[model samples]
Target chain A: MCAKDETSRPKMAKPGRSFTTLLFFVCCLLCLLLTRGQKDERMSICHLSSCGSPLADDGKVYGMCQGRHGLQVWGRCCVNVTENTHNFTVGLDLSGCNIHDEFFQESPLLTLTHLQALVLDNNPITVLSSEAVAGLTELNYISVPTHSNCSCPGGEEAWNHLIRSVNTTLCLKQTSTCTRYNEACPASSSHCVEDGPGLFLCLCKEGYHGYKCLRQGTFPMSAFLAGLGSSTVILAAVLWVLLRRHVKTA
Target chain B: MASISQMWRQLKSKYSIYHVFVFLLTFFSYAFFHATRKTFSNIKTTISSEWTPQFCNATEPCLRPEKIWMARHLFDSSSDAEPFLGWLDSTFLISYAVGLYISGVLGDRFDMRKVLSLGMCLSAIVVFVFGCLTEWIHLYSQPVYVILFVLNGLLQSTGWPCVVAIMGNWFGKSTRGLVLGAWSACASVGNIIGALLVSQVLDYGYEYAFLVTSAVLFAGGIINFFALVPSPKEVGLPEPEDGDDDDDDSEPSGEEDENGVTPRTPLVQTDTDPPVTFTQTRPQAISFFQAVLLPGVIPYSLSYACLKLVNYSFFFWLPFYLHSQYGWKETVADEISIYYDVGGIIGGMIGGYLSDRMKKRAPTVVTMLLLALPSLWGYSASPNNKTINAVLMAVAGFFIGGPANLISSAISADLGRQDLIKGNSEALSTVTGIVDGTGSVGASVGQIVVPLLHKQLHLDWHWVFYFFILMTLLTAVCILPLLVREVRSMKCFLNYQLRRQAAALVQDTHRPHSLNS
Candidate 1:
């Protein structure tokens, strides 16, 4: 019912407690004050390294590190991400491009019509938080391929569970051939037909139709018709604008 | 559910008395340790004032190749030292590595209070030992520092694990990493404190700088040992507050059940793995040596090595790089170092805070690391004007320090969420040694690598910056997969640990009947 110290050593203050104890007490007070003052002066410190002051560039400002390094601008951060779309894919390869992290949540990645596939493969993209995944809906594919080289062989499965729990089809894997949660084989895997998680492959045997080559890429023309319908809105806007200008001129 | 007043009372009962005393003792000892250790760099002006005449005999305008050699006083730079700084890092790294595993294993094997106290005692003794920095008397300071650092690395490692073990027993896992990491942000606190002390006495005395630091370390060690309780079980308290009915606690509990047992109530380590328990399970328990090396040491080593490259470079050369490149005075360099430290503070706290809040450690780490990569790449691409550069440096510092602080501080403790080391006193120390010693080696390589890269290319200092960029980028790549594995494994590990604890609890209930009958 009770947990107690195992050792039963007699409690006697160190032999010179009276004399040194006073000195130590004062010293402790002094350090606490000194350290406090030090803390106040340097209270801005945080986890990642950052520049101390802002570097003014004509009208553009950048963060300047004490070590003479230059930080990127927010606008530049956007540019950097956009310009290196391929790099984001590499970020995928590196597992350093989690779209669900704050970068996507806080930044204008949502408004950036330029971003295509949002890859979060191998990165800790397990967050199903609403904000973290909000901007990610803009992308065509949201992949967070789980690492196969894990202590648990079911990383993909867990990842699928996380994605599924959110009720979003943001793929957390590159191929639908996740060896977890569902029954689908990867397009890349040698096994043309195998059951897997979040993975689907159609291994068309000589005359098959869908998955397992049975359905092929043939959707009833209605899916393509739906895709065309979305584009018509844009064309309608352009035509409306052009007609308004013509009427005003006439 | 516990009320806020109940929590306040708990804090009062726990830390109000003895812990306060422990805090004060630690605070002072740490001051002396830092004050004395860094004092040498400041008094460069005074020492050179004394020795300048001998070197520049009446004519040649003191051609020492170093900018401020003869006219320099204490804490000033010396042409003589430029070459030595590189190898000095090596000395520290090699010695630190030599005892890396031992420090962790031994700290665990023995009473950590004793081990930590001794580490502090030696840091103070050796710091003062190096106080008389004459050519001959201080020759061994580097290697002695290595030994000191290794032990310190080991000792400081003791800090988190002990705190974790206690906190693990006292608090829930929900806020443990956050609190520990917030506590871990003390590293930045230590650095800033070291810098401040340097600023105060840079003109006064250099040796006292280190000696004071040693004293502070001694004090902190004493406080830690005296105040640190092994676990809540040891202190006779129930597991964390507000546990009665919280929705957050439900998922973890369920997660634990599916895999067999409920994942340990997020953070708090239940009263199970005492020395007696460990001994009782001797035949059945996983071997300490095997567990130490397999997943524990291996991951720690790899991550440590990768991070070391970045850590060592930033810590040792950041100030110098600022001063030399920006034409900053000593005061300015010291002041500016705060930016990096400040970012680290935020990173440390946020990294842990967010992880615990979300109940996911690996996700936090991976997210931060991944986010940091672009920042690192951006920071590295250019080093144009000073103001802009400074701003980016702060941002870079945030990305680099935040997640790093999270892992090194709180996540490391969480990683050892296993049976043998669950809330054990030595868990943090082992992780620290594994992470920090490897970081030391990275520092050593940066010491040599950056300088050599600059030497060969005759390019701008950006070359050195380039080296860090590649290192950070590479670190992100290598760790990405590993962390994914960790996250997946952790899910199961949590299940397994909970099952083991729950099973043990059940067995303990059955034992009374069997024993009495």
Candidate 2:
């Protein structure tokens, strides 16, 4: 018999189909949420190796990965540089590197504005200089920690001094000493603050503030906060209906 | 009520040609819907390229545009990339399979016109919105961008069911193949448009092209809303009442079903003829949740997924294959591949015409599919050599693309039996959704699996053609028996009985093909 029934639904259906339907929707919601959750996860990665440094496309670079020697381009290139948008971090896993200026020229800690960290713990970074870090004004952490026999004139001390010169408020000095000297040092560019040795923090420059401290905003905090509150409730209501009713059906 | 109604009987009035007018209008509406639905498939290159520089290529610039989910993939590891592509495709396929069961229920329970229109509008909006998203959001991870495209797939699922519902309502047994085949051809046409337009836009900017294509579907949505009429009954007319003048038996009172609930006409009417019937009202509507469980939906849904795997693989990979195997760029490869679509247009017309004339749309699909299987082999084995493979591929396109529409459109129509079921044409769309959604799942599968196989086979990307060949063969063999039943349903196939009835005229070999029965 041709049992392709159009007239009536099968009576006494088991609970199995419903379970499947529920599972199906659960998967869809999870996919949507997971995709939404991974917004700004970085695509640039530095594979740690002994001889090779991650290739940076050369000094006058439009794309960061353009000149890096060992660095491979992945799915799509995400870095397009602009005035206020440079949150990409250049990580140095010198756990096994014989550091040459190719490291500096390629990732010349100087050019990166929002450079966050530089780690050369187990590397032979014998000759370090300020010119090597020509453009890196906004570096926060430069850990060359635990050197058995360190180089450079002041060793860690000269590096500390370099951090201090970048911003008078920033130094290799202890926090207690810095707090005492705070009054003596006039905050010239209030946007700049010293964080560590050869590292200072850049306060989102000005007229711009977002998650990565990237996007520019027109309104102030109080007005934006008020707008946020009303919209939050509305967004919540809409999400609830979409997730609850439509999710169940869609 | 209106003067138009009152004056209608006085004016030169015959409801039959009005049937023809509605038929033509409905057919065109279905065609336009197909055109718009297809607008997105071709633009893969554009959207992929546009989102590329913005997203950091996750690993490499301009990899596979076929990998819908990999738009979110972030790592540069090729090892990780291939497997993840596979996983993502599985995700899409699983969701598609899950979605299929309920799609039928949704169409049946809801007003299919509104449902289909809403789906198109939303798809357009989602695609357009996703297009605009290239400008706004810049989250560059495997998870982030993948979600956007996944949503795109989910929304796109609505198109098949909607179009199917429309096609089912408008055609019947005699012309089902021809009509459905034409509808499927529209799908190919949409892809062709999608490929050309997307490539063109990508050359300029990826964002604008995506936005434009997505937004254009709104036009289709609007047309579908005004143009889709459920059946002839919706406009206060009867079926085309073809009233062919050669009936010998005393006629049954066709008027008996005027109350709109018609019983199934018994098969005893003639063992020598393909049964002909007219539209009768459906018993009632089933709710969306309960519709999938209504038997045959899941089985058909599974077969649809299998059938789609071959087709979808071709959809996503054909351009890339052409480019890699031949010395061609993405744009050139994509453009040239459209010849396949052109052949599809011809194949669909031919298949449909044959099916309608012979009353065996399903068999036409089986036959073309069988022909396509070896063509896939020929295409895969000899892609570079022009004399053999290129011609073979065009031939493959003819059969493959032709049958695709014939089965999906006319077969779905025959399955719906709108003539038997009456006003419940809405479920037809849901069944369509289930079928096409199943196919989308397969497409996602092919997108992932073909690439993985290509890598494994270590053959130059010709593995895509190979995959199509194997799958096409399997699908053909599996559906061949279905064709046997399909042939028997043909009024012409009952040759022994027809010859017995007209022994005097039996030797007359000059019977017009149209009157073979």
For each candidate, give its TM-score against the true structure. 0.51, 0.54
Residue B508 miss distance in model 2 (angstroms): 17
Which regions of candidate 2 fall more than 4 Å away from where they truly are? A1-250, B1-97, B139-142, B199-204, B239-283, B286-303, B383-389, B418-426, B457-467, B488-500, B503-517
Q: Tell me the lDDT of model 2 at A203.
A: 42
> Tens-digit lDDT track for model 1 on B1-517?
4778766644444332323332333333334343443444454444333332214343322321123223333323345544544454455456656455456555455555466556666655555555434322424333554454444433333333334333333445566566666555555555557667655433324444454455555555544444443333233333343221223445643433332322222123333422221221112222345545634445545655666677656766777777777777867776666677677667767877887766666677667767777776776653545566666766777777776666655555554444444433335445555555565566667767876776766778777766676776666665666667757766676787788789989999999989999
Question: What is candidate 2's lDDT per residue for B151-231, written digit by digit as tens?
Answer: 655655555565566555544455556655655655555554554555554433444456555544665555455545545
TM-score of 2: 0.54
Best by lDDT: 2
Enumerate the candidates' DockQ scores in order: 0.00, 0.01
TM-score of chain A of each: 0.21, 0.30
Poorest stretch of ten by lDDT in candidate 1 chain B: B275-284
